[model samples]
Target: MSSYTKLRVAIEKPFGKDLSSAIELADSILGNLNSKEVFLIDHYLHKPGVSQIVEFCRSNPLLYSSAGLIDHIEIISSESIDVRGRTDYYDQYGVIRDMIQNHLTEILTLLTLDLSNLTSPSNRPFDLNAAKFDILKSIYPPFLQSAVFGQYSGYQDDLESDKGGNAHVNISTTPTLAIVVLHLQSPVWFNIPVIMVSGKKLGKRETIAKVVFKKTRHVSLRKKNGYCDDIVFTIQDSNGSSFITLPSNHNFNLPNDKTWTYNEGDGTSCSSMKTIPLGRMALKETYASVLRSLIRGESDLFVPLSNVLESWRIWSSLLLEYEEGKGEHLMIYNKSFLDNLRLTLNGSTLTVFVNSSDPQDNLVSFEKDGISFKSGNKTVEKIKEKIFGHFLYKFSRSSLAREISQDILDTAITSVQARDSFHLALPGGSSPADVYQSLVVDYKHSFPWTHTSIWQTDERCVPITSRDSNLFQLSKTLLAQVGVPYVNIHPLFPVCHKSESVLNEYASINYFDYVLLGVGKDGHTASLFPDSVNSSFSPFDNNETVKFVKLPLDYPIKVKERVTLSMERLVKARRIGMIITGKDKCHLAHVIESKDKHNSSLPFVQLLRKAKPGTVKIWMDRNICKK
Candidate 1:
């Protein structure tokens, strides 16, 4: 090794889990490399077909022109099979980590690279790398609203079968399919859609990159032909690199080629056409080519560190939404959803409907960049009215408590009947204290106490024996009055085991059968405050279902430090019961329901959006709904 004059190392895909980790890894590797070039190996970049995209586009006038007028670009890499017995591995990585983050991203950079930045037409590694870095820097993060995630039907069944009846794995929410739209901030491709699609268990096994050009007035005579000028690059159907140009009335606009033939039909349509097959490049397998280049010190095919970090930044928000379980609606595959989605994106509009059994519930209408909820026959306001009217139960003080208690009992019985255990999460507040008392006085004997497990929604950092502790309040109100087993009570604080053990236990339990919550004047349901501690503890970013929160000293709460379940976990419940009691709470409820200025910051609104439509039960006094 000491004899070698120079050294170049090639690293594999998945440089890190996220932006922060990628930066850390990049710094560590560069620090020890002593100014040597590091090659990031993504086999897609080295594929002969994909590698030829840049040259092919630059040489052909039609392709080069289309690149300038690019309306949108679609990069697809899909498989026709499911996990294929890779349950453990696939469940963790999913399609986003496995495909889009590296393979498809690299292809995008290649297609959108500023060819003019290159000093020469030669395919020099250093020149290409520099050009790609420039484009990567100008790209903005993907818009979360424009992204759509999907999971094929029967995915859970397949996972359980693969793991030999691991029910925990059966509840996994990993997305096997995703369609993310990205845009470049640069003027060359500003606001142009760069759609990347990858998934498992699809219609067919194929990989292609398509460039859809904007309509031209020059082809007005070709109206009613339904013809489009699209250039498609593929490695699926050939032994080497090739691209197919869909012949249009403008085929003559392209350079002369022997393979292309055109015909006219009454000067109104394209009656006959021939696809122009671009020249092919016979090459070794993708990995073999990449390794050969790595050994030869060719850094052209390798992804640079700057590109890696920028890519993570583009996907950071989306990953956070996924962690919070509040991202795009994950539609099932093979249903009308994917089919309609394909047609919608390919057509002049971007309207797509979610896959649901009910026609009214399936309506999800929006344009490119966001999904908006629209009723099938009624307006959005009407729908909201129906939602709140059905879920919001107004009663007298005593009747509210009795109704809540009955709902809890009913949920417990149903859960115990189905799974032999009724997992319930209870919040601590003055509002729910009476409800807990009613549960003890009325249904304690008939409730499924033996099969019920009580979990604290939140607890103060103070000792369990302290009066401020939610556990102490529960003990005084319900635990002492009921015949529930001690082992069935799960407290957030004063645990005998490590915190990791607690998290693992919660994860194994998966979701609560019912969660009883109380809204604060600040619009916080659990211990989740309006302004949380920091990014590490942000409700939308943290992956932990249970998090330890240390509030600021200036916060208006008796307890500064607390432990609570995240909003992500609360939304997973089969039923969520929220109790609002006072005049201030009534005002806060209106503010939350109005979708006003504070809507985005309120945890209450987020829960409403993330929770299943019919699962939330609002138990409030008559005054709360008077306005």
Candidate 2:
């Protein structure tokens, strides 16, 4: 679908690491008579929509952030159509290498480009490449481990047949669908998750880029009529109807001019201005611009070889995961629209139909970001004003359980498979117990129960027969159901407290492959309570793997005996999951996160300080984390 025509074509062999061999093949096959020009089309830069998106993303300060303030970027490109050519080429690269790795990735760079300090747009054109490269390097390239891949039904059928439909071959496992989450590690955008998804033969065909506003305290407008005011730009055609109406609209690739119209919708916080969302013609020209750049040797219109190689590296890693658990599709947001924000908190669900309709079949609230509510009765002030922690929150308990349990299983599977015996340390608490029970009951089938071993992070030094025992709680619930052998369960017995045998057994672990921990209201964890006398004798002083500390005979809990793992030991784990619940703990969670002097007595704070950048994740119930 380009206006320009190819005068000549040359592609001799499989496309991969070395592009030279193919170029060399042409030299010998036709004896290059001093070729005049060469071009490569990484066409994302040429699409009108992508171009305008990139331009606006790079140029505008109000809409996008140059200060790298973007909390997250979600890019989803699904099409109702399928490939119409030979399956051999399509099957080899699949949707990942064919579309996502190149085109979609380019869009990511444009969406997150850091041009904030650039005093002039003139310098940004050249600095853009460097900025993007820095962003990718900060993230250390998208890893294959963070993505999932799939194929539609006919994709395999096509792969089994030739162009003529005469011969048949074994069906190949090339993915026609890919969903990945990329993170940025820059100083300004650290730990930001950029979710990118692509597929063919899907329910609809639309390319979309949605930038989510951060959770920072943003101001809202309360309308005079008791409703909240908002603002937005709309695109219209000559008749002032929605700009895209018919199928032919897809072919309108001409330059935008005075014919295009723009207007404001809903709340008008800002003045109405002219704006045209990227159109098809503009998208087509986006790629066409690359063709022109190729003739001129302009790297501006394409991804560099280094960037391309980094993408391939990420894709290669993703291939291994897809090969094994491709069917374990999480469906994280498969049914949910990106624009619809449906949050469930403490039995209270607030759903805003900002952009999509599929969700709101039964929600109490509705409206778009820039539009006013149908009625002003449900004003923003009707709800109590409160400040949840300024931190991220997840309100759904089921979601929290699902995500954390899967994370544990994934880690256990990978670890136990890599080593003869993988160790997982568990903490005793309500939220942790809930997740453990969920894993034992609901997700029991998903665990690697054979090669894994369980270790209690802290134990009530009472007899296993005592109700105060941590192992007793785990055994009655998760351990009782799973098939993991009794020998694999390593419990810190009260007799082992202050005994060298405990230290020897704990030391043999090398490190816990996974750790499931919890945060208490007083900022305490693993029996290491703040302001407690034993807090001073904490293992953090010497980084001990295991510590035996006895509390006063009248200590707060029923049992005075305690045996616990140290921050030194938990930090060595391959991954850690901290489950925090109750909105009351949000402020405490924020304080514990700081690891300040006051929080130094908390064990979870110490573990976080010693852990790797991406090794630890806190799964808190949003009902507690939110106001």
Candidate 3:
């Protein structure tokens, strides 16, 4: 007998009335093996009598100690078996057997018990010829030397006379129905086979013990973990000849004979595998692929620009032709011809010089004898409002302003409709005020004006009635007149709350469709003053709305508090239209067309850089582009 520090016994069925005979038969066989631990499992607990038998062993420690044979005994209930009817008996038994072989159970107790106390039948009759054939058919032939069997007799059998039956005579055999014990003799079978027996008369085959061997084949591949291959074995009889080998190749059709050939002598081996590219390598490859296409001019990065510019030109020309007889109105054009314009890597810095015939030629010209325009403090404020105000009005108008504004407005409105929402940042001033009034007058009949919501681009920290209050002006000029449902309009309430909270609330909204913006002669838009204090604008914040800011200027004129959309929010708009009409705006407009980051100090320059491609349209009179 080999020494095992710990013994784990899993029973297929508990010692109950239905399984009493089978348990007795199994116990007799196990007794021969001198197993120290015996475990029983079944669906139902043992009867009262069986329970008492177990309790007796637990109470008397000294009488039933580990020194005795079968030192530990345990009984447990397993609900794994599901028996539907009489036909399911085999399946239920098979399930129970699998549980025992798989060692699925909680250890109820470790009690010292004596097997000797249990009554053993005086005799057991077994068919020796049948048992031998069964044993031979079950075990692998390579391990035939490990198989063994024995027989036993009681006193009555020894006393009985041979050939003739004597009075009070009894014949007894081994106390087991069948016993097949296999002691693995080969090194490969060492610690592999123990005991295996199966018989329908034994009350269903309960336990199935399987031996699993793990063989690993190493292959070179690019991966954090090496590849794994699996192979299965089916044992049928002794001498391995009755066994079948599982197919290893996925592509090959299995042979009917179920035999696998090991290619060891053929010098054939599995191919080395490759590892997937990861980390920086993968990103670099993807970016390089895209950049390469971009550089090759196979892909266009200015998607929106192409679409918007073409649409604007076509629509503007049509509107100009339609409104020809309406009135003498402003006409703005891209003053620089293609030959004079320059395209660069940084889109913000490009310079265009307009000819004298250009509408804005005199307005923005650098000639010493030209208009010689100056942007005073008041002029700057007025310009910012006018630019933004006119931009919005152009969208609402049917004239040339509307034609230019429609390109951007249509794109924005369409985008908003697709998303089921719309938003805009309208600054407080006469220009924006006029734009709103124009929107109410022009688009009220065409769009779902009642559904549109309005918000301030920036507000002064004052009551809504105050002249500086953007919300007050918008409400009076647009929101109130358009009859846009009050619920749709979200104004900064109290007009006195800290602008930050309002800005934060604005940022929480989803994308905005259109954001009407103005330009200051000093190159400021909204409340963002170029080279002034409180001009910081964050483009990295995840919030989708505008930010509020205060301006640094002279006392009584300095914007103490103002709300404005962040550059990020403005750029994110589907359409951004800038309206600049006066001659004072020519220099700033010139800067806008220039491709220089240093020129970004101009508010419009920043706006253009951040604007979605093709979505930005500058609607100006001939005066602003003159220089």
The candidate maximizing lDDT is 1
Candidate 1 lDDT tens digits, 102-121:
78878888887775653465
Which sequence of candidate numbers ranks them by lDDT, best first?
1, 2, 3
Please say which candidate is ahead in lDDT: 2 or 3: 2
Where model 2 places Cα greater than 4 Å from the true spot, the runs are 1-40, 62-71, 117-125, 140-148, 160-168, 214-260, 263-274, 277-288, 324-627
Best by TM-score: 1
lDDT of 2 by residue, 388-439 (tens): 1212224255446645665676566557547866788887767687687757
Better of 2 and 3 by TM-score: 2
Name the candidate, 1 or 3, with the larger TM-score value. Answer: 1
All candidates' lDDT scores? 0.67, 0.54, 0.36
Model 2 has an lDDT value of 0.54
Each model's total of backbone clashes: 0, 14, 35
How do all models score by TM-score? Answer: 0.54, 0.45, 0.35
Residue 436, candidate 2: alpha-carbon lDDT: 77
TM-score for candidate 2, residues paired by index: 0.45
**Between candidates 1 and 2, which one is better according to TM-score?**
1
